[model samples]
Every structure is written in structure tokens, then in C-alpha cells.
Target chain A: MPYTDNTFFLYYNKSVLTETDVASLDGILSKCSAGKQFAYPMADGWYSSAFYFGKGLGFEVTYNDHLAETSIDCDFDNATGEAVTQAMWSYVKDSRFKADANDSKIAAGFNDGSIVAAVTGIWNRTTIQNYLGENFAAAKLPTYTLYKGTADEEQTQLVSFAGYKLMGVNNYSKNKTDAMDFAEFYCSRENQIKHFESRGFVPTDVEARADERVQADVCAKAITEQLKHSKTQKSVPSTLWIPLEGLGNAMITGAQSGSFDLKTQLKACVAAIEKTTN
Target chain B: MGKKRERIKPNVFKRLIFAFKDGSYATRLSFLVMGFGQIARGQLAKGFSYFLFQVLFALYMIFFGGRYVGHLFSGNLGSRLSGERWNESLQIFEKVSGDNSFLILLYGVVSLVLFCVFLTVWAMNVFGSYENDARLERGQELSTFRADLRSLINEKFYIPLLLPPFLGLLVFTVMPLIFMVLIAFTNYDYAHMPPGKLFDWVGFKNFQAMFSLADGAGFALVFLRVLVWTFVWAFFATFTNYFLGLVIAMLIHKKGIKLKALWRTLFVVAIAVPQFVTLLLMQKILDGDGILNKILSTNILWLADQRYFSLLPRTMIILVNIWIGVPYTLLMCSGILLNVPTDYYEAARIDGASAPQIFFKITLPYMMHITAPYLITQFVGNINNFNVIWLLTGGGPVDNVYYGGGSQAQSTDLLVTWLYRLTTDQNPKYNVASVIGIVIFVISAALSLITFNRASATKSEDAFQ
Candidate 1:
């Protein structure tokens, strides 16, 4: 049912960040200057989840027919999550790291030569490609050093959420046969290739993905590689985002200053995620 | 004797009883069958119209309204749980329909309102029949249907003039208001959405949650903080705009101020721009990496810094609101300033009063007395001002201490903005939003009433004149 990929990986300027430098967070940050920063929208819930999800923390939400969350079991406040939060705080405090990047901001920053690298999805492919030109490059999200300055420090690959845009025919459609035929035709390999050729949407069909054009795409290859470290976007509770965003915002703002207790903030975030109203 | 008798108007119940007791046979029959007296007295059009309404009410009650009213009175909104059923032909499960609670509540309220309207018409029918009997006793000829139509145009012209708007208010305003108020008492939230699930009335639970300081459900802390900020923001946003506007208008109006029209036009240009466009432009310009920062070569977060309890963003929003709000106030004050009589200034000058004394004794007091109502309205408007704060910061910089943990409130949020976030957030808690809405209404209403009553404009209207 999938039509294209809907997840984020690293988009770096090849001139600023070599392949070796793009392989690690420390390497990327070292190359980034105060003026030309590495953009990561950690204040956003979608992007912030990468840090916790990379450390094997996630949520299992149960939804009823009404699409209401009936129950949620989330482990984003566990010991490992606290360590991940600490590790994020280490680089988030760096002057070269920008934690508030949105799509337009990333494009503008790249166009103005203020951003050397950013973490975002394929939706910004055309704009970033236009801005960076021949220097446009993408790769799987880099490894982050967890629990730095201690014996437990380890280089772990950053995980991301992998989502898909799906084409579906409603069961109650008046012309079910026609709708099904249209859906099939719309998602066919050739049409998907055409779609990618024009709109830059990565096709979901296996044969379509194997096309020469798709294989040549750096974004497509990065997305394929990133999928190994990703979790399916399903089963994420609606309550998760706002609280995680709050947590992410807190990290970027108060983490370096030690104005907030990370453990307490994490506990509160988890509590809010599991909160239910009768 | 007749004049004295006419002066003593009988109450409705007394009139009804007296009509039934002292009326002729036709009037007595009309008590059982509406318009019977009117028809017997040869007012055919009016009588038939009343009879038509009776028949229509009966048909509506029997066919449509009876079911919804019954469901409303039953108190359980709906009982059927939507589920999947086996379909042998399709070889898959198909969704079975269930009672939709939302529609039940909607139609129930509509039926209740219509019943009230029907009762009003029934009272009119009885009263009309009684009047006819009284007219016949005086040996007066009954007015013809054509004469009645003529009266609607001549003496009762206001009826047709007001009817459409009255009906519109009842349907569009009153019905939806009651529906929203009722939602505050119910468990109608994301989890209890209708059609697929049922929401039961949980009276005062949402309100308790809002005010309760219990850990994990401590919205009270957030509410109190936002409430304080709302008041603070309103106080500053209103008065700052007022005084600054007065200053600007007075400066333009001062003697020897060359090219006054040019000054006025410049301010008017600010007003001509749509408010959202201006606010959005301000948002972009004041952003961390925006043009302002680029120009200043500084990395200061104009709208996103939460340090010192979000002093920066809060200050920036109020400052931006002044830019948006001052022009209107300036225009209003300009008109009022011209209206202030020249005699007061002449008298003050003759009395050797300084300019400051003259402004304080004459101009400022006069402006305050005349613009008291405007100030109160502006204050209440500022309290519920959602646009400037929302478009600028989206109530952001996300203060972790109070607004975190799914509070959905932020440092710079007004009650209206927080209420907005509650309803629009991914996990919408509509009941809480409605409760907040009711709170805003109560606050705005009480503040306006108390202030308007005490304002010198209301207290001594003739004193100024």
C-alpha cells in the first residue's frame, strides 16, 4: 500500500562534510562552525524521537475502532532514555548545533550558506538540492556517543521513524472496482517511477526501487540504509508528541544551564504520555 | 369606571381562568379547540392559520420530535456499541452501524427548542381566542384577515423587521451556545468520540480536573500561571496602547506640527495592512535567525527565549501587539481630541495653568470619561486576544516547569490560546476546552459589567455634556 518513504536522514553539504565526517555526530559538529551550523530540529517531536528510539525506547499504543488510544506502554523514561537525554544535551549545548531547524529554515539556512548539514525528510529534497547544487549529499543519520566521559560511553547509530504514504480504497466506495483499479494503476512501477522522476517521491515498489534512476539517488540510498535502524511509524500514540516536544524544548533551552532536572522532566513527560481522561 | 378597570391588567393565569368562566359558548369551546371562537366569529384566515399551526405541531410531535425528545429524557446518550459483523458473501467482516450519540444530542436540543416555540404559539392562540370573545361582547365587528395583514405592515411593522434576525439568533447563536455549554459537563473527548464510541455525562469532573492540584493531573498550576499572565498581558497591552496612541495623536494634533495629514497617513498605513500579515511579518523578522538578527549581527532569541520565565518572548509579543493595536486607538483618540472644546484650554491658559496641569485637568480626564467604555472593551478584548500571541510565538519557548507534561499551555499563552491548543492538539480534550471557554466568558462578562458600571462615562453621562 505504500507510495513513498516518509522519514528523515542526514542531508549534508559534501563540500563541508566528507563521507568520513558525516559518519559520526562528533565529526559533523567539528566541521560545523558557529556561523555555518549543523541544523537538527530537536525541539520538534518527530525529530527528537530519533535520540530515544536510537537507544531502544519506544511506545506501544493500542487503538480502538474510533482511533482512540485505549492503552499505552512507553519506555522513553527508562535509565537508557535518561542516558540518551544526557548524550543529546552534550552536543545540543554546542554553539555550532542548531536545535530549531524547520524545513523552510533549513532551506533558507543552506541558501544563505549558514547551514552545512541538517536532519530532515525527503519533502525538502528539491529545495535543498536547488540550494546546495552539486554539493548536495545525504546519508543515514550518524552515530551518537552515548554516556560520554564514562566507561559506558558507546557509539550508537541514530534511529529514526519510518513512515509511508499509502493509497487505499474505501470499503464503502460507490465504485469499489474502479477505485481499486485506479489505486493499482496509480501505484504501478512505471507510474511510481514517473512520480519519482517528476516529484522526487521515492517509490515503494521493489522493482521500481531497483530502477537505475532510483539507485542513483543519494537520498534513496540513505533512506534505504536508515530503514535498518528505524521503527515503523505505526503504534505511536497521539499523546506522545506534545510531551516529547516539551522535553526536547527543555533539553535545548535548559539542559546546558542545568536549570531543569532531566530525570524529573523525563518522568513527567512519560506520565503525560500515559495520561487518560475518562 | 371603565378606565379604572382597564388599568388593572390581570395576570396570564387569571386571564385564562376568567376567559374560560365568563366567555360565550364559542369562546368556551376554543379552550379545547384552538381558534374555534375566531372561526365562529368569521375571522376565517386568522382562525385557519392558528388551526394549521396546531395540526403542524401535532404532526411534528408524532413523526419527528417525539423520538429525539424521548432519547434526550432517557439520559443515556446512546447504548449501542459499534462492532464488526461477519459477511458471508464478502468473506470479511463489515462494520455494523450504531446509534450516533452526537446526532442524538444535537437533534434532542433542537426538539426541545422547537417544543418551547410551540408552547409560545399555543399561548398566543388562547390569548387570541379570548380577545375575540371580549370584542364580541362589546358588539365590535371582528377585524378582517386583510385588515390583520395591513396591521402587520402599519402598526406591527417591527414584527417582520425583527423576526428574521430573532430566528437567526435563536438557531445560530443560542442553540450552539447551549450545545457548547452542555459539552463542558460531558466526557466528550478524544477517547469518547461518538458513532464509534459513546460519551456519558460526567458533570463537574472536567472542572475538578482543571482546578485540582493533584500531581500528574495538576492543570491548576498551569491554569493559575496562565491566568496571571493573561491578566498581566491584558493590563499592559490595553493601557500601553491607549497612552502611546494618545501621545501620538496629540503630537500630530499639536500646534506648529507641520504636515499633520502626512503623519496621520503614515499611522493609517499601519492600520491598512491586514493584522495577520503584519504579525506574521513581525514573527519572521524577529525570529532567532531572521532579518532582525541578521541586521544586528546578534544571536538573541527574540521570541523563543524562555529564560527568566519567558521574559523575552512575553515582552516581544506585547511590544508587537502595540504595533498592531495602537493605530486603531490613535484614530479613535484623534477624533475625540478634536471634539474636546477649546474653551477649557483657553480658560486654563487664562488661569495661568501650565501645559501639564491643563492636560491633566482638562484633556486627560475628558478623554478618560469619554473613552472609558472603549478602554474596558479593549481590556476584555486583550484578555481573549489569540491572534497576535498565536501567530507570533504559538505560545512557545515551551517552559518546562509549568507547561510541560502535556499541559498544552505555554509561557505566553492567554486563556483563549490555551483553550485553542486544547481543542486542536493531537489528543484533544474538548471538555476541558469547553470548561476553559466558559471560564473566559464568565471572566470577560464579570469584568466588563463591573468596570462599565463603575466607569465615569456610565455613572455621570450628563456631567460631560
Candidate 2:
């Protein structure tokens, strides 16, 4: 087997990390995964799970691109009369989605299957679980390796992850065997448990992933289940421009504009993907 | 044989130099004779300045301006990766090389026209120089550079004649035209970008795709449909505004109408605000849950729904335009209306002519002639009326099947909106955008030319008389 380096490359969203968050994370890393170096690169994609881990794990964060901080105004929890009315109207009049009589949109009730389940950060775990109740389940992400995109055909052995830092070998290390041993020990079940309990991640070790206590944690469990269905957000250069959000916008606009040719547009989009990747 | 042929040649270059220096042509060709001779005759500094200018011009061509010229001609698109697709005759995939034959043909045609122009200019310079030299030899005083500059201001020749038009063309027409023309050949899109990844020439692919019944042909169809609607909208908007404005002006101008100034001011307010802001406010009012909808309690999805949106907005804009546009026409026609001879109307009444008959015989013909230029200008203006379509629906509540929308906005997108989308949207398809812009300009120019020519030609006919 190839000797793995103990260094984990962590990518985190810059928005979620404060100076205090970084300090607290450093303390956790010192108490838990000592002697292991973690590098957290700032990326927008890291807003999902990566931000949570980077803030909680005290990873060594670095970045090249600096995005101007944009404040997003969210009115999700307000539930004001006007808000409810607007939401209800949007649900009913979307024209794209048809609703049943008992649909939550019609009822103005707490929707269960509307979101089905959302994979959130460890901080929101309890809040969301309480909000969702028993309608959802949580499990472990099958692998620790993050990939660019799906291969032409699905292969079970190739479990995908997104922005998960892994311990890798330093090809030019003087003490190769020692580094290998350290990496193995760092990622072992015992160490991973220490890391997970302090930081908030499903342990990379198979045994630790199955632990009862870890499974009981709502956020951790949901992320674990999400991991099973996880396909890496495409890492093609074109994906940089066509973010998941941008694609969603395109879909909405396509439906709205009635005149735009989506199929050819999508094909041209794929060709763009191929060009950028090469 | 070459030596014998050289004896017959007059050595035009040497002769020109001699003619410039000592010959009778010096005064006539004063403008062209200034630089090089001054250096040779010990005015080194001035001669050096001219030499420096020549060098700068050469450098500009080599490094910067030439690329635009090259882009116009061929763009060297044949060398791109897409151009390397296997030719059936060659039966092998290779980098496509050599000049584009079709582009070469175009260059030949444009070059022939430019050559004629060059010859005319050269002849004028030589003739003028010779005339000046002959006059100088006869002791006639030479016109100085100061005199030439003064003449530009004083003569009221082409400068006074062409300044307003030249400035308008430079700002509104030429600058934009240049930008658009450059876009047609370059692959300025989401994939092929500049600065990050340079975009090169793509030849006539954009035009070919637009015209052909290929995958991209659907865009052409949407463009055509939108173009048809655009023309229809222009016609309706112009006539509606014109007639309504004329009627309102006449009514207000009548002796019986009270608060003439107040009524004029009230209508003028609609025209006062910028069209973009007004249209945006109007869009909000007409939205599904907007003020109008809320009051009406009818789910007449004016903007949100696709089916009704296409047809309704055209009529709605014409109506809205009448409200906003009629006042300008009213203001203009007011002055003209007052200028109509009251004696003619009195004479008509004396001759047993009815009010309608007098209006048809005297008022209508007089108004059309006096305001023919304004009417032509307004028609052309409506053809390019971008703000109304842009703000009202944002050429949307958007669709994907529309060529202009490209899965972003829909078929309701006007050529201008689509051009905006192409130039400013996520994927800047500047090449296609430019093509559309030029096409729009051509259409507008053709319409304006016909109207302008007709107005000038028929001015003597006295349509009303």
C-alpha cells in the first residue's frame, strides 16, 4: 500500500470563518489531532460541509482568490403575514410545479417532504432535526476522497466526496516510513473518534463511522446519508462559471423565457464543459 | 531590356521631390511640401517631428490598429481548432491553413472601393500643390496654416454643414458601430473569452449558423419573429402617438378648451420621466400580485404567463407609448398648428367648406410637410426604442427556446434586449450581438433614407395644396 501523508488539505468557505472561530478550532486541533497539519483553502463551495469542519477542526487555511463579501438578505424564519402570503402565492402560481389540495403550500403548514431532508452544518443539526422530526434519517458519507465529477459509468468502489481533506504522502520526505506510520495512526479509528467528537465530521475510519454515538448526532447522520448519494460538484473549469446556483438560475430563466432553446443550449453548455476541462 | 525600359520612365519620385523644392508647384502643394523639405533646408526640428509621426503611425499599425483591420478582413479563423475538422476531400484531420477564400473575395471588393477613394485624394493633393506653386511663382501670397484654421470656422462650408451630423455619427453611430463590427468575428462568449483566455477570429460561422437550418437555426427563427413584432410595434407606436398627440394638441389649442397650459403640462409629465424608470414602475404595477392585479383581483398574468404575455405587451406598449409619446408630438405640432394661415380657413368657410373638409384640404397637408423631417426622425426613433421593451417585461418573464434568450429569457425579447443579453449577460456573445446590431442599423437606415428622400423630393409637390 502507498504510504499516506498525515497532512489534510481542507477547503472552507470564507464567509463562515471568523477570527474567534479560527482560534477555537486551533485549540480543538491541539487537544485532538496533534502533530497533524491541516490546510484549509478558502473556496465558495466550502459553504456546505467544509466551513463547518474548518472552523471546528482548526485547519491551516490558505487561499488565492478573494471574493468580495456580499451580504445575502434571507427572510426564511420571519413567517410574517405578507411573507406567508408571498410564499403561498409563489407556490401556487409558479406554473412549473403542480400542487395537490393537501399540499403544504396550500395548507400553509410546516412542510415535511417539501424539503425531504437538507444536509446542514453541525450547528444546525439539532435545530433542523427538531424542526423535521422523524420524517428523515442520517447516515455516513461512504468515502473520504473528493473527486471532480462522476466517471462515464458508476463504480461502487469509487466513493465520492466533496471538499473533504485527506492525509496524503509527501513524496520528498526524508522519513518516509515514519510519515506513513504517523498518517495511519492519525486516521485510525481511535484518533478519528477524537477528531469527530471535537470537530464535527463523520470519522474517516470505517469502525468510527459506524459508532452509535456518531449515528445519533442528527447533522452528522444526515451528512452520512447524503454522502452515499454524493457526486462531486463538477470541477471542470466551465463549472467555475456555471456554478450550481447559476445552473439553477438558467433553469428558471429557461422556463420563464419560453423562446430560448434549452436542449441545444445545454448541449453547447456540455461542449463548453469539455473545452474548459481540456 | 530592363535598362532600356528604365530610360522611358520619368522617375516620378525624383521629379516630385524636385517639383516640391524648386518647381512652380510649391505654392499649390504647400500642405504636402512642409515637412521633409524643411529638414533638408536646415529646419531639422520640424522635419524630425514629421519623421517621428510617421514612425508612430507605423508602430500603431504593427501593434494595435492593424489587429482591428485584420479582424475585419479575415480574423485568421481558419487556424482555430474548430477549423481543423477533417475535410472530406483531404480525408485527414489537420490544422486548417491558408487565407479564407470567401474573405479574400470580400477584401477584393472593399479594396476596389477604397482604392478609388485613395486615388481621388492623391489627385487632389497633387493638383492643389501644383496650383499653389504656380501662384507662388507669380508672386501671389500663400495662405498660412492660421488662415486654413480660420477658414474652417468662417466658411460655413462642410464643417457647419456636417458638424452636427458628424458628431452624432461619431457618438451614437460610429463608435457603437465599430464596437459591434468588431464583435461579429471574435468568439466572445462564455467559453471563448478575452483577458482570461483569448478569443480569436471565427470567420462567418456566426452568420452561417444564423442563416442555416441547423441546431442554431432556431435562434434565427426567434430573431425573425421578434424582428417582425418589432416592426409592427414601431408602426403602431408611432401612428398611435402621432394621431393621439395631434388630436390632443388640436383640442387643447381650440378656443373653447380651458386651462390649455395646465392640460399640456399634465400630459408632459408622462414624457418628463426617463422611460426606463417609468417602464420599471409600470412593470411592477402590471405584475401578477402588483397594484393593478390586486385591485382587479384577476389572475391575468400579464407578465408571469407566456401565452398572453407575447400578444398583450405589444398592444399595451403602443397604448403606454401614446400616453408618454403624444405630448412631444403635441408640443411640436402646437407651434406648427398656430403657424397655419387662418385666412385659408376663413376663405374655405366662405367657400362653403366644412371643418373636416378644411382640415383635410388645408391643415393635414400643411402639418405633414412642415413636420416631415420630425415624422421621419420619430419613425426611426421608434424602430430603436429599447427602453420600453427592456423595462416593461425585461423582454421576459424569460424563455429558453428564444434565440436571444438562450435559456435565459424568452421570445418576447426584442432585438435590442437580445443584443443586451448577448453583450451584458453571463455569456457575452458579442459576435452575434454585433451582427444583430448591424442588421438593426441597416433596417433603420433604409427606413430613414426612404422617408428622408421622400420628404425632400415631395416638398415641392405641396401635398395639401
Candidate 3:
């Protein structure tokens, strides 16, 4: 049974960013001052995937019964991925952009008014709401410019990885019938609404989502809007994260401006992800 | 007298021959049946205890330990791999039981260690029986069970006192060490976990993978970089703390300095707080957007910038470590500095020695002679220092150009942290981690042995006195 949408969107200060400014990465970066920065955790694997995935680049992985990766097919090192890498580098090179944002940093930044906007998930909705008070606002991820200053430049909406929480009964459970009944009861629409009311978990059930409280939540609406531009996070190899984190760290550290070859780095990263041992 | 006793001490084979050739009838019988001679001589308590031990060993071998010992010689850890079988009646697949390689290895090691212990006890029983025969031939009065128990409390008190700790060391330290060392020779990794899968003995393949650059394993490259950084960090961490601590201690001990107790108490307060807490606080303060940067009104990435190959973060880590480390040395050096005899300074002053000359010739030499071992220990501890680096940087500001893709090592990682990452990673390579463990042990052992042998403290222990 589905529980809620698990994805990220943009959280901003409405006093600093207008609705039009929140729609594009350029507008947001331009509006952000040195004192009040825009935070995006590009050095993290989970957040860094947005740029590549937004351009339709992804990985397909296969594993044996032992959960060992048998093979992986990935196109994240191709030309499309290079263009996405360039787009990420463009923002990271800006002084107004903070690339090392984490849970604590985001909270501290919002509380001290050092960060005007940040890209994070719904898990932080309550803390951010308390910090921003009436100035709190949310929207789907802004459009990023690709191949800027070139003839083939384009603006595309940043895609995010969406995940779903599910309740399942173990196949070897001693009381399978009871377990199944319990799992179903836990995911029922009324229970889901109760869960949302208590913990701020967005409901997966359509009828439960139509509840007055959920309908008015800016974070829930933003999540729903972001889901339209999201890809399902399934079958991603465990090897993908470390290498991708390295690449993201490199991009944010200005490795792109040097003689460093992005294509070779991406190629090595893909090869590492696909590597298998006997 | 000692030389004569040493000459009389027979080898095991000679003693066994002598026991058999010149033994009484009961002693000869005791060769095949343990404690027979003692039983015939009416040492009921000793004889029965030996007999009981033999019975327990035989039962353990027959029931519990024999199969694991057999499997140890089977080459592969286990023969069968676990899988699932179809159950047509229930329309489901059932899990099939198979040999667990991990259990096989663990039980095998335990059985081997127990066998060694049993052999030692068996040797004691044989020798004890022979001693009983000798006492009878000499027409000496034998100690009864009560006297034997009394003697254990008196003459053998040290044996009872040492036995429990010895057994504990064997079980906890020695057994786990052997298990980890043996894991280096096997393919025990995340993919080959037991029950669902079985790992085989790969024999030295992990070592080769770590040392060979031709295979593109990339471990050799990472090893060299981490090893070099480890030594470099240790040297700087040790010496910086030592010299600065010595200077602070001298300043406090100087005649003109007032509020000496207050200064010492302040430094002691630094030490009172838990080390990890101080390190974590330093981490937050040194962050790119932390309080330090805000105070300076500059956006310098004090600990996160990886440009120029993470020079900023690495240097900041050593600086933060100095903050946490210097106070400990300060406390130690203060005590040692006080103990430096006033007579040496008086003699040096009479000889018209300059301030720098007295310090270099008399003070520095005395300090070094006493603290040589402490310095070496501090050096080795710094090499394995995981807390400061882990808390401050997490071995990060990860430079992909140097570490490459798929490498868990970061630019700031010590070998210990890298080994930790290898074991905790998603695709954990236990064999590789074991190999790194062995390397760290060898390096620490060699360095400590070489330095300790040459150190003035060990070489001339009586010189100062």
C-alpha cells in the first residue's frame, strides 16, 4: 500500500522571492544577495542526480538473489550528462550559491536569515514553517539553463527522484492472514489522514489528500507539482552514490574550470558503478 | 647450581623415553591411561581430576568439535551453498539449509585452540604421574589431597591470580585476532555472506590486489597516498603539540609569571571536556559558513575547499587537533619540567651558559631523554587518530582527481579511516579490510621496535639517576 510522496521541492522566503523569481534558477540566483544565499546541496549524491535525471539520463541495474549487483547499464556519462554537468557547474561557480547545504545547515541558515531559499524534502516542512512564519512558501524546482551562451541553449525544469513508502507482509510470517489485514488497516484512507495530521506525512490516497488540512499545505502542493516532473527511484545500484558524490564534490569545488576532463571523469564514474567482482 | 639444573633438564623426547624405560609398573600403565600411576599410589583427588579432563575432552571431540576441525581441512570453507527448493504441494519455494562458512571458520578456530589447551593439560598429567613414581621410589612421604590444596593457596597463589586474566586474553583477544587474520585469506565479503552464499579461500589474492597497480584495483595508489599522509600527519601532530606544550609549561614555571594556578586550571578545563565534543565544536566553527568565517567577514571555505588538493581542510585539521592535543602534553610536561633538578640550572649558570644555550644543552636533552617513549607513543597514536579527522572533515573535501571514482578514500583519510570505510561500505570487502589491518599492525610494530631500541630512555635508563 502506498503511504506518501517522497520527493524534494524548493522552499523560499516569500518576502525575498516573488512567484516569477521562484520559477527560474536565474531569477532566484539574481535575487539572492551575498548575506542571504540560495542553498543547494550539490555535493550530495541524492540532490546532485536532479540535473542529470532532469535531462533523461539514468541507470538500469541488475542484481542476483544475494543482492549483489550483476550488471549495470548507465548513460550518465554521455553527451547529455556532460551538458547537465555544465549547468550544475554554472550555479556552483556563483558566490551567492551555497553547495554544502545539509539538514543542520539548512535549519541554521533559515533561522538566522542567511539562506533565502533552499532545495530540500518535505521532512523539513515543520521546522522551516516555524522559522519563516507567514513568509514561508514552496514551489516545484525551478528551470535551469543548459548550454548557456551557446546556440543550442535550452531551459528545462529540474527533475527530482520520487520515492514511495510501502507497507508489506513478510512471506514467511507465521500469521500471514493477520499480518495482511494489519498492513491494509494501517494504510487505509482514514488512518493515512490521521498520520498526515499528526506527523505532516503527505497522503498517497487521493481521497485522503482532498482533506482540508492537506489541501491547504504549501509543501504538499509543491510535492504534488514536483511529482509531475519526477522519476521513480527504483533499481539504482548501491555503487552509484559514492562515485556520484565524488563528481558532485568535484563540480562544486571548481574542478570544471581547470584542465579536468568531465567526460573522462563521467566515464570512470560509470565504469566504477558497473564494476563487478567474482 | 643453575647451570647444573639447566643441564639436567631433559628434552620432551628424552623425558618420555626415560619415563617408559625406568618406570614402575603403574607409571608404565599411566602412559596409555592418564593418571593410572597416581591412582595406584592413592592420589585419588589428582587422579580423578585428570581422568575427568580426559573424559570431557573425548566427549567434546566426539560430539561438538570434531566436525568443525574436519571442515577446517576441507579447503573450501564449506561444500554446500544455500538456495531455495520448490514445494509443489504448497505452491511456494522453501528455504534449504546448507553449511554456513562463517560458523565453520569460527568453530574450527575454537576447536583448534581448545585442542591445544587439552594437549597442555595432557602433558601435565603424564609428567605428574612420573613425579609420583619417583617420589615412591625415594621413600618420601606423599602430600595428601588436603596438603595439595593448602600448597595451592600458599606457593601457587600467583598461578590462580594470573589464570583468569590469561584465559580472558586468549578467548577475547587472541581468538578474534586469529579470525580476522584468517579472513584476509578468504573471499568473505558482502557478496559472499553466509546462509545465502558461501565464501571460498582466495589465498593472498586480497594482498596482491592491494599492492599491484597493474590490475587497476586502484588500492595500491590509494594506499601509498594514505600511508604518506598518515606519517606526515603523525609527525606534525606529535612535534607541534610537544614543542608548544614545552614552551607553555616553561612559561608557567618561570619566576615572573603570576596566577600560575589559574593558567593551569584553564588548560585543565580544556582537557576536562570530552575530546569528541571539543572536536565537534571545532568542526562547526571551522565550517565554510561557520562562526569563524562570519566573524572574519570572508567566505573562505576553511575546511571544505578542495582546490589545490584539499590543502585548506588538511591544514585546518592539524590546527584543530593541536587545540585539542596541546593541553594533554601541557599537563604531562609541567610535571616533568618541575622534576628537572635545580642543580643542573645552577651548574649551567655558574659556567656562564646563555639562556638558549642552557635550554638546548641541559633542558632540552633532559626533557627528550625522559619523554622519548611518550613521544613515540604519541606519534603512533596520532597515526591512528580517527576522532579529530573524522569529526572535523569526515576525511572529506573529497578530491576525485586524486582518489578517483569508486575509491572510498578521501584526501584527508588516514589508513585507519580508510579501512573503516572499506568494512562499512555498502559493498563491504572484509578481506581487503583485514589486509589493511595486517598492514597497519606491521607498520606500527616495526616503527615502535626500531625507535624504542634506539631511544635514549631505553638505551640509558640509569644515565639520569
Model 2 lDDT tens row, A1-278: 21111111211212233223323223212222211222211112232223222112111212222211112211211223122222222322334222111112211211323232122234333343455455433332222211213342111211223435468756435565677778888877787778667655556566777788776865554455445444443332322232212222333333344343334434333332222111
- lDDT over C-alpha atoms for residue A76 of model 1: 81
lDDT of 1 by residue, B1-465 (tens): 011236677897787777777777877887767777789888888888878888888898899888878977777888898878887875555678788778888887898899888877766777787777667667787789999889999999999999999999999999998888888988887778767778877778888888887776658888888999999999999999999999999999999999999998898788788999999999999987789998998767788877777888999998998888889889999999999989989988999999899888889989998888788888998999989999999986776566654567888899999989889876688888999999999999999887867773467654863
* Interface CA root-mean-square deviation for model 3: 3.9
Tens-digit lDDT track of model 2 for B1-465: 011123464665664554555544332333354444334334355445544655565575566545445545664423322235554764434443344423432343343344444444444344445444555456776565556567888884677779789657655665555555756766656554422234556778777655554563324666677787777877788877877788888888988888999998887888788876777888878764368866986535465344433566566666767767877888887878988889988899899998789778888888877777777777778777888877776665433223332323354566777778767775456677777877888888898889878877875644556
Predicted candidate 3: what Cα RMSD to the true structure? Answer: 3.5
Please give the lDDT score for candidate 1. Answer: 0.84
Model 1 DockQ, alpha carbons vs. true complex = 0.44
lDDT per residue for candidate 1 within A1-278, as digits (tens), equals 67899999999999989999999999999898999999999878898889888878888877767677677888987889888888887777788999877888999899999999999999899999999999999999999999898998889888999999889987656665677789889988899999999988899899999999999989999999999999889877777777777777776666446565678778877877786443
True contacts preserved, each candidate? 0.37, 0.00, 0.32
Give me the candidate number with maximum lDDT.
1
What TM-score does structure 1 among the candidates reach?
0.92
**Which pairs of residues collide in model 3?**
none
The stretch of ten residues in a row with the least summed lDDT in candidate 1 chain A is A252-261
